[model samples]
Target: MAGKKRSFGRVRKLPSGRYQARYLGADGVDRPAPHTFRTKRDADDWLAERQAELRAGDWSDPDAGKIPFGTYAATWITERGIGASTADLYRSLLRNHLDPTFGTVAVADITSARVRAWRVARLDAGAGPSTVAKSYALLRAVLMTAVDDRLIRRNPCRVKGASSAVTPERPTATVQEVYAIADAIQPRYRALVLLAAFSGLRWGELIGLRRRDLDLTANTLRVRRNIAELHSGKRLIKEPKSAAGKRTVAIPAVILSDLSAHLTVFAEHGADGGVFIGAKGAAPRRNHFNRLWRKACHQAGIKGLHFHDLRHTGNTLAAATGASTRELMTRMGHSTARAALIYQHATAERERLIGNAVSAAVEQARKQAPGPNGHAAGT
Candidate 1:
């Protein structure tokens, strides 16, 4: 039934006198190698390696990884305990980028070469670098889970630095530009422009705000929840993406009047009602907001500015306040220095002021120094 000795494998001679390698696995079932070897020694060697792996507790059950990549990947994504938006993103990437190639492929059959080939084909087929990178990263994460499950001994998505996308620097609007955009938008959304450019709130967080979220006297907005609008016109009010994302950001006192006016004129609901609303008294979704965003940019003479650029403008303005790196991170709800460091660079206006001050200092030094003789006595 089981092997003669549990520690070592038992070999048998096949019908054609070839040796067959078989071992009683941890499951107490006799399993043979995929192929028979010509010599007993060859079969013995294979069993020995398998035995060594078992002894070391590093043996991966071949049957464990027989699950299809798509099935297992979908399972992993669902049980990952991530946010809804994150799950939705993973599902999209798996469907759009990975499924065509690896859907029917067994997890055990996904070799490094196959993964590399899929990535190459995607890049050659006009997929953007960022898009491919995101998909590849998701693939890597799923394969890593397989490794943890002992379905695979190692992950095959091994292209180093393939996970990091080289994103172009986002354009930042100036203070005057932000004001112009605000003035050009519908009166109902004017405060939206000002708040986006001044408070540095993400669109999701801004649209999810209610009347009680704003503290006019304290000039602070509490970011408690965020809304993700689906393509089906459904909105999901979820917790902030990260622990740091649920933060209180202080609004500039300058926007106090504009915000007050917006509350009185536009926000007709009670304390628990949404701060921003459309004509139907519902919150503005992305598509509806996009139309207004386009109109405002067009009227402001800025042809290609996304709503996100206003947050960039606000972050740059905060940096201009000489805020420390930690301060910027807290304000922007970022946990990493990489994102904080982006706002550390001075804005164009601040740099101009520095340049002018440097020029004045040089002029004063030249005036004090003696001409040609380089003496302070002017000799």
Candidate 2:
């Protein structure tokens, strides 16, 4: 039988004398309290809480929020529509970081406290800061989607600065060291080293370059695509990572001659042919090049340097040219000014040189003036 109406919601007594509470949801669908109550007052209290949740706009679908973390996470990843490399990275994160702890937990059950504990446990397990940050970022993104899907009221990723990775200072090669390493490499790859240290192009971009990408007379290379090899040995060719990555960067006058020589001697035929190829005329993979690069570095006495550091050297040298941040971004094909800022900051050695020059200028100025300790011109 129907019972009395309350200020919040209607409560009715069932045939078994238990009370049932039902409230009209903000979604316009009437939903019952999660369970039956022994007393009318108990049912009324349950309805009151539901009303408050609705008023606060924190009410979510009870059924939808019950989805398991792993199930929803998989759905979220599929709906993201990201690139293949990015998809692989997210899958790796799920497999390595998230699934073990949160997979069975319901989305609604996730709390900020649990998230903090996860981060602490990851760090204690020897996970690096960058790895943890990336994992946390992926988790945050997925949970944000859950919030949008109305599966959860709020995201549990409350830790600030947990989404950004902190990288150690990258070591760069000097121009002389670059040349020494280039000279130590196979003659076919001499131009490769010069272009890497001078152009700021990434490995994928370099390996993706074709004969048509270079404008020899104009002394420029057009960056349009990139190629990456997955750990599973699958190779993917895709557009540049960012809009700014597709750009035209000029080659140094000195590198022009060497590039010309490389093109004449080793470049494969046809416009679509790769500008850089391995021993068998196939595009060079990073693993295959790693062995040769290690040998060259060893021979040049710069064994600790990674090939990616050549880009740092190139950008730093470009900054030394007094290029503006915008110009640096364009030349370096960086989407943000942060990298340009890093390149522009003078090195400690350069700072010392600047200090010495300033001191010398001050001393010369003092000697030229009629100071108390200095002789006058007509004294």
Candidate 1 stretches greater than 4 Å from native? 1-7, 10-19, 230-233, 352-379
Q: TM-score per candidate, in order? A: 0.86, 0.81
Give the lDDT of residue 369 in candidate 2. Answer: 56
Q: Tell me the tens digit of each residue's lDDT in model 2 across 1-379.
A: 9667767678999999999988888777878888899998898788878888888887877878888898888878888898888888888898889999999899989999999999999999999989999999999999999898888878999999999877788788999999999999988888899999999999999989999999988988999999977767799999998999999999888899899899888888899988888878888878988889999999999857999999999999898876899999999888999989988898786688788989997777667758485775444
Candidate 2, lDDT over the whole model = 0.89
Residue-wise lDDT of candidate 1 within 152-254, one digit each (tens)? 9889989988887797877888888899988998889999999999989999999989999999999999999999975456679998878899999999999
Candidate 1's displacement at residue 347, Å, is 4.0
RMSD of each: 4.4, 4.6
| Each candidate structure's count of clashing pairs | 0, 0
lDDT of 1 at 340: 79
Q: Any runs in candidate 2 off by more than 4 Å, and if so which?
A: 1-43, 54-58, 348-379
